[model samples]
Target chain A: MTAALAARDLVVGYRRGRRARTVVLDGVSLTLAPGQFACLIGPNGSGKSTLLRTCSGLQPPLHGELLLAGKDLRRLTRLDVARRVAAVLTDRHDTGRLTGRDLVGLGRYPYTGWFGRLEGDDDRVVAGALEAVAATHLAHRVVAELSDGERQRVMIARALAQQPSLLILDEPAAFLDVTARVELVALLRELTREHGLAVVLATHDLELALRSADTVWVLDAEHRLATGLPEDIAAGGALGRAFPTGSWAFDPVEWRFVFCGTVRGVATVAGDSLHATLARRILEREGFVVNPPDVGPGVQLAIEVLEPPHAAPTVIARHAGGVETHRALQPLADLARRVAADARPGETPR
Target chain B: MLTEERVAAHPEPAPRASVDGQAPARGRAALVFPLLGLLLVVVFVLGIAVGSVPIPVVDVVKVLTGHEPHGVYHAIVFDIRLPRSITGVLVGAALGVAGLQLQTLFRNPLADPFVLGVSAGASLGVALVVLAGASSEATFLAGLGGLGDVGIAGAGTLGAAAVMVAVLFAARRVRSTITILVVGLMVSYLVASLVTVLIASADGPRIQQFLAWEAGSFRAITWSQLHVLVPVLLVGLLAAAAGVKQLNALLLGERYAATMGVDVRRTRFVTIGTAALLAGVATAFCGPIGFLGIAIPHLARAALGSSDHRLLVPASMLLGGTVALAADIIAQLPGADFVLPLNAVTALLGAPIVIWVVLSSRNAGTLGA
Candidate 1:
């Protein structure tokens, strides 16, 4: 089967003045199948948005060819393209006091007659679109009165009403809260699988993209487009290569990237104690999931937790003073502290 | 039925489908409204013909059927009442269609030709002609003189053109619909102030004529003027008819319109220019008749149960013309000899309908506080 959308060696740009122009994408190529949900991810100014716009035919490519359903984009009329591709842009415009149902029904304009009289099928399409996006209850509510998440869902519903084979969204999750974003991603996943819609969305939420998308299109600083499986891109350190200077690094173990400095406080505790357990738990909750052991002079954890919600047991000692605390192992110290604490405790602590 | 089953992925199609097919069965559905409008036209014509002089309905029919009637009867039907009634129809349809287009284009129920400053432009144009020495008598004679000299009507068209240009420019520069409306109001205010200054500075006779013209009258329109107006109004109505599809596309935003294969920029150009031409020409000749444009579309929508302009435009034109003719008959009815400014008569009907629309909006009612 032919790809629903394909762009070959495309360059995209916008005119700044009568003559001057700024180019955002250069020689990029990509293809999306009917049932694939693809995500375009990059740092700001990396031109992911520009590429998506070009592919959707909202913005013309400065060079190269775009094909939709086996027809060249340039050869297709505006109305013909509209019947095939749909989009949900980032900017929200208030169309006065229109109902959500009215807004969605507008998506059927291309198919409706000159008078825009709603035939039976038009109403059915609009209703199904509303149901698909879970915005049926909001059908009668004025569009301007909807919440951001609700409004976003309404926009999706409107796009669905077009009954286009391909749907492109620009940051559909941008205004949504965490839970809404997750639900929206899951919704996109389900929509692709059920309807076989070729979906392309641009978002900064990398975790969601990694979790949901069938393919990831990464835009490098040089404007090169790279398309592959999410895991392959993560493994290649393309994110670090794309964004070089930040505190960004690929965490091979977790299969993701983190963008923060490495934490630096060390503690040593007695073997078989609770403080070591409590310290590890606190650090993990704080996004510091890595714990590496050292051969020379680091702390060793030996701890246990009691009943529910109670602090665990641990041992800690200072090397110079040979100080050791028992019954309540507060903080952990280095290897030298364990030797000194062993002398202080005199209990042959492991 | 097979096609129906194939398209059944859509929910809730059955009710709408039945509604679409059963329009004829519904009480006072689309056909009834148009037929009623035709009946009103007939009644209005007879109302205009039968007067204090009490011309027989048969004489009125004979006079309208273009046969030679008795001396005074012919003079009354053709010379006096016919011109007035036709003028009412022309102005009413023009204002009504213009109003509907404006309201739909702005997506605001309150939008009308007068509120959008088109009428102000016409008023300014008329004020310039009268205060500038082409008085109403001069205007009437100019009509008699083969429309050679520039007068109130011509000035009105020029004024409307200026307003249309300003509003269109603002629409291009400012993307927000509300901002465009505020700009239109501001432009109208400035033009009104200029008209006021002209009135204050005018000499006595010119001031009296200007004031009278502002009151708005249909009696001044002669048969010769109707010849010019009928063709212009027809052309404008035809132009608006071509734009029904474009207007439907515009019910959504320009972006969506463009996405749906509508040439947004081109639609805006054609829709605004043609609507402005219709409104401006009608206002110029008819002395800025009020309310028909704003209210007639609503009445048509109520009658037809649809907002699609293909039906709404023709419905509005016919309905508005009928209402205007009826209103003219009522304006002439109170006394045998006396007459009223057509604007006052129209406002009595137009204002309440507008208020009803604003009040009917559940949101606007709450926001009114």
Candidate 2:
């Protein structure tokens, strides 16, 4: 089958006049096969929304060809695109007295004739959409009264009711808590597989996207769009370039960003995972970089501990001047703070 | 984290729509239309029978059925009461629909033709011809006194159209409808000042004529005038009907509606145009009736408990007509010789309902802070 969505050298941005356009992303080409879940990542003001809007036909691209299910997007009317591509936008709305079922029913508008009365089949489609999102229990609830996660599900159901081949969402998980975001991404992924749809979502949940999305779309600091496997994109340092920061470091192995504090000392931690992790966190927070325990034992501060994940065991800190034992990481961190203030890392305390 | 599990088939769609609950709300909402329609008829009959002259209900029915009624009953029913009652239904239905559209279009509970300056625009049009027509005009234009009711109404429409154009222009340039609301208020103030200037320049005797119209009444509609009035009202209602789908989509706001294939600008244009037609034409004929336009839609929603425009359009029409008819009866005060101003009577009937809606629905999403 043809690619579910393809953009050829697409340039997206705002039009200042007839001849001048402020392009945000230029010469970008990307494709997603059916049943692929792609995440679009970029910094704020990086034109992710503009690009999504352009791809979904809500806005005209500054230049380029966008194809939806092998048809040129520019040639299709809104109704045609709406039939093929449904989007969940970021606009907050007050849906007064509209039940979840009723809100989902609105998704059938592209098929509903002028009067817009939902027929038997349309009703079934609405019901199916709600089921797909696992929101059947919420179907009778007033959409306005639902919690954030529930309402976002209903909004996604509204889009699904259109029965589009490709789904585009702009920040669908914006207000959701961590668990809700995970559940929502999983649901979208399942829908893509079960229904054979191509899904593109723009989100700020970087770890979740990297872990779950089959394809990754990254807009680098230069605003150039790159598409690759999530692993490839993460390993290639594109994520780092896109999300430039002063002190936070992306730990590729653990698949998370760890805050690296200013280093005033060098330290080594030798312990089980539980003690070592906490001990290292304390050292890092106290402006010391924690290295492995292999550096010559007496050369710098070194900590050794033995503790279960839950049990509190004593940690011994040894230095050139003296050795101190602490019951917990907090006091140890305080001591390290004082030691660093007294003398720099790799130097004996004055 | 994304994980691959053994493939399973899709969950089965629900066998039927959720029906165990919501039946009561649905049933009640379904019953409201016919009940309001029945109320409309009762009040229409009351509006006719309980005017300055207390023609008995029997004679009111007899005259309506084309039977000969005794002792000036026929003239009262045909020449005065019937026209007034018809005007009530048309004007009420028009204002109600227009108000519903305005509120939904701007997403403001307080938005109405009167609040948005459309009525003031129409009033300014009438004021120009009635108060200042003779003072300045090409002899190509005759005196205001000679510009029949139709000409005054035409003037009213021109004013409403002008203000509507400005409001639409602002809707395009301004992101927030609340800003448009404030601009509308200022525009009304400007129109009020102009009306004051016209009143200041007008001769003393003509002030009574102007005030009578300004006070608003259904009594001035003539049989010949209904020929002009009915068609215009019908056109307005039809425009509103054509826009029901777009308005429903708009309840989700413009961006979602656009993604759903709605032409947001065109929808806005049609909606504002419909509001202008109904409010302008009604104001042209009825002279700036207030409260009914704004209050009736909220009442419709409360009664039906749904914001779907399909239901709201008709519900507001019936409820508006009924309330306007009832208000007219109260204004006449039955046997009393002194008649209250129709605008005041409507305000008295409408203001509390509006206040209650705004207050009660403060957190109900419709009027959330």
User: Which regions in candidate 1 have their CA more than 4 angstroms from the true location?
Assistant: A42-49, A90-105, A116-163, A173-183, A219-226, A236-259, A262-292, A295-350, B1-74, B114-118, B134-150, B162-197, B295-311, B322-340, B344-369
Over the stretch B168-256, how does candidate 2's per-residue lDDT look in tens digits?
A: 78767765656777888899999999999989989876677778888988888899889989998999898898788888888888789
Q: How many backbone clashes are present in model 2?
A: 1
Instruction: Give the alpha carbon lDDT tens digit for every residue of A19-72 in model 2.
Output: 878988899799988899999998998789888998889888888899998999
Give DockQ for candidates 1 onward, in order.
0.20, 0.39
- State which candidate has the highest lDDT: 2
* Clash pairs for candidate 2: A265-A345
Error of 1 at A22 (Å): 3.0
RMSD to the native, candidate 2?
A: 3.6
User: In candidate 1, what are the lDDT values of residues A174-244, reduced to their tens digit?
Assistant: 77899888888888887788777789889988777876899988877877677889888777767666666
Error of 1 at B140 (Å): 16
Reference-based lDDT, each prediction = 0.71, 0.82
Q: What is the lDDT of residue A345 in candidate 2?
A: 45
TM-score of each: 0.75, 0.93
